[model samples]
Target: DQQVKQNSPSLSVQEGRISILNCDYTNSMFDYFLWYKKYPAEGPTFLISISSIKDKNEDGRFTVFLNKSAKHLSLHIVPSQPGDSAVYFCAASRTMEYGNKLVFGAGTILRVKS
Candidate 1:
């Protein structure tokens, strides 16, 4: 079974609107949660992150929320622009014997219309 899941396969929004992406996890051992944005022919770039201890974290137009109790997280983008169109991924990591290993969910493609 997949530890991380993104039920929605895609999302669409108009420019200057809000875009919300949701994710769920089955692992309680995951302490760090992150969101990454990926473009075609490129790797995913780190976006926003939240620790299990924190309920929310924000940076500029991006915000990430974590609900430890529910094992859920969500990423929100405000004033979504056309350039924001890309695949968004949710990742979780836990400190292991060797190092931190990340488990990623299937990405959600976001389409931002101008």
Candidate 2:
């Protein structure tokens, strides 16, 4: 079962604090990992991604680290802001698949208070 799982259903943080989200997977076939942030009704937008070939990937305020050996990964946001408050979804897929189909976790809702 290549299912992605986010154990935490929600997280809350101060405006200038760090926000860390965790994820786990059981499928050994998943070689690519991604994080997406979503607002109320809009679709999720790709935030960051790491290939199984690499251990880490970062983009601006977001960073993703993949530990394939343990089937774990995390997304970190430094100095989290109110704008960063949203549902975060961890997704995985085989990088070399014919078409990229993402399997997403239930999602973690982040709340940032000023």
Candidate 3:
């Protein structure tokens, strides 16, 4: 069973506007949530992350919020720019015997239009 899901396949936002990407998880054991951004022909880069102990985390134009009760999370980007257009992946992890293993969503494509 897939642990993470990004229901929306794509989203479009105007430059300088706000873009919201949503994700949901079924595993209550997940202790960490992460969002990654990927450009065309490039690997995904770490963007923002939130721990289960916290509800929100922010970094400049990016923010991540986790709702444990709902098993949902969202990534927000204010003043979205054209360069921000890319695929975003939501991942979750929990501590294991060896280490943490990430369970990733299918990914959502974001288009920031100028």
Number of backbone collisions per candidate, in order?
0, 0, 0
Q: Candidate order by lDDT, highest to lowest?
A: 3, 1, 2
lDDT of 3 by residue, 1-114 (tens): 889999999999999999999999999989999999999899999898998999999999999999999999999999899999999999999866325578999999999999
lDDT of 1 at 15: 96
lDDT of 2: 0.92
lDDT of each: 0.93, 0.92, 0.94
- CA RMSD (A), model 2: 1.2
* Clash list (residue pairs), candidate 2: none
* Tens digits of lDDT, candidate 2, 1-114: 439999999999999999999999998899888999999989999899998999989888888999999999999999899999999999999867634788999999999999
Q: Can you list the residue pairs that collide in candidate 3?
A: none
- How close is every model to the real structure, measured as TM-score? 0.96, 0.95, 0.96
| Cα-lDDT of candidate 1 | 0.93
Best by lDDT: 3
Which of the two candidates, 1 or 3, achieves a greater lDDT against the reference? 3
